[model samples]
Target: MTPRPGRADGCPAAAGQVPGPQAGDAPYARLDTEEFTATPHAVFEALRAEAAAVPVVVRGGIHAWLITRYDEARAVLADDRMAKDVRHWRDFHAGLVPFTGDVAVAARRNILSSDPPDHTRLREVLLSAFSPRRIELLRAQIARIAGDLLDRIAPRGRADLVAEFALPIPMTVICELFGVPADDRPGIRTWTEALFHGAAMERMAQASNEIDALLARVVEIRRADPGDDFTSALIVACDAGRISSEELASLLRAMLAGGNETTANLIGNAISALLQHPEALKLAVGEPRRWPQVIDEVLRWDAPIQNSLWRFATEDVEIGGRLIRRGDAVIVALSCANRDERAFAHAAAFDIARADRGHVSFGRGRHYCVGATLARLEAQIALPALFERLPDLRPAPGAALRYRQSTMSRGLISLPVQFAATPGRPAATCAS
Candidate 1:
């Protein structure tokens, strides 16, 4: 019996029927649990070959697709037919974990969840604070933060790099950029951590409330005491009627949430990768000029963000020889796309020398990460500084290292390491 047209049973139309330009492939209806837990590279290979636009039935009887191949993923991400706004799909929004208050309200304001005029307006206003010139100016400050963090950790002989250094470089820089007070950092960090990990419905509700209250306070403080910071810049934009107060708050939350954990993970993942691959470290230390390449490789090898935010099909679409009807949920597997053999040579190898750029780690098209330059600056300074300070750094003995258990962000929860201490010396000594 032929499946009824436009009926939502999480199944594609009959064989020989092509739905549209963005339709998904077969074998999607039976997505395996093991697929999510497998080493990311393996999953990438499977998605590239078998399911570039693979369709699957997600929780709550919703039909969705995963775009895996590099070129295909880019097309899907850049294409207007594949929409970022999930509100277009009734089933998609219905399945989402609900939010309690303003945090949930703020989430709706971020550029990631919006389209066209609103997206363009919000991006233009926020771009003023994140311009390349601005990011370059922050380089020296970022370096100082990296240096100070290394100075603190050097005396310990061994330190949990994630907690002691990796996490602080971006967090400190972001706080300074946003005018978040020194005293409020610890509390902000704690709340941010909870929000990132709060994936389930109940936890998400709690996180939403926490973030809402925190941001409300920060906004109030900024209003009373404006200064030369992103928050102040946003306030100025709002005063000019370029953005609404609600939009400003949402943008601020997005900037903080996007910059903090993502950059921290990049640092943590890069450090862990360096420790695991000494040859890469040697190249980085022996020739500091290679830092940019190393940073790129680390990002490709283990991206900080594991998955792209959900995208919805605006109309009937066909991709990879399958048809997907209008209003279906789709997720672009960025981690998988980064390793697509079609786009990258020796896709799985961690070669610092690989001549590869244009990685989708920053994503593509309208919703590409606005903080890419800042993130690169932070990693470029932080990773090299880490190796230079702890030339003999190694993972701590008898301590288990664990990656953050999250599908959203790929990072180490803790990274304990041990090394011989430099006695009676400046805590941090630069080479040459």
Candidate 2:
């Protein structure tokens, strides 16, 4: 018997019969699992070739399609039919797709998960805050933060760069942006770490509550005593009745994650990439102008955000000659698309000088990351500063980086490195 259209059972459609899941392909359940995070590139490359729109079972056996081809991924991301509104996702609404902790918390309300008017409204409010001019204005401050982080770590000779340098700069910036007091930052960092990195739902809930309480207090204080900060600016908007309290809270939460996690990872990933290629490291360290190119290449080669958040098909749609049933969850492999053989020559190679390196790491269309400029600025300043401070900086001899267990964010859990303990280091030790 012909299966009913949109049936959950894995079967070929009568008209557009696409290939089923291949043998030995890892299940979507592996997302956020240790194995998947360690090495997702190989699998993504395989999928892009074999099945650009591959079907897999996620946690709880929820069926979803993963798009890997550059063209297809961009098309899906820009297609309004493939909406970001989780409210319309049948499986999630039906409670068939179970999400734990931070995933569930973030899905409730945020620009990342919303669609249409809600997305527009949420995005508009924060757009000005992340404008290019604003981000450029942050350059000097970012450099100082980077220098200070290095000063403390340089004396140690050996340190986990991820913990000592990469993590703190963005965390500090985001806290300052949100007007989070210095006293509250440590606790906020703890909550964010648990919320994003922890696997247990119970612990995640606890962290979320703690964060919520802290944010609430910040909002109240901002309301009472408006300051020259992002949160205070938001409070002004709230006072004018442009946004509600709930929306304000959700926006702040989203910014905290967006502002800190991705930027930190970008810095770490860039360092790792350069360290592996000494020539590139020499170029980046010697010529500061090449930093922009290096940053762009790093974004494409080892993206901080590997895959886009979930988007569900609003109706049956044909993509890459495959039938996607309505309400089916679709994820665009941003890292994979950036490395698509069809789009980029020598896709696997990490060449900073590569001219064709426009990547979807910050996403595309209306949902493109609002924090892109800030992230790039932070990386631009942070990378050069670290290299200048410790020109002989190299990865710890035998240490390996463990990636954070997450499908959405690609970041190292730790990155150990050592540099010579030298005083009054020349800013440009390499030949210009």
Candidate 1: C-alpha RMSD to true structure equals 5.0
Per-candidate Cα lDDT values, in order, are 0.73, 0.78
Question: Candidate 1, which segments miss by more than 4 Å at Cα?
Answer: 1-38, 56-63, 93-107, 398-401, 423-432
What tens-digit string does per-residue lDDT give for candidate 1 at 242-292? 998888888887888788988998989888888889998898899999999
lDDT of 2: 0.78
In model 1, which range of ten residues has the least summed lDDT? 97-106
TM-score of each: 0.86, 0.89
Clashing pairs in 2: none
Give candidates' CA RMSD values in order.
5.0, 5.3
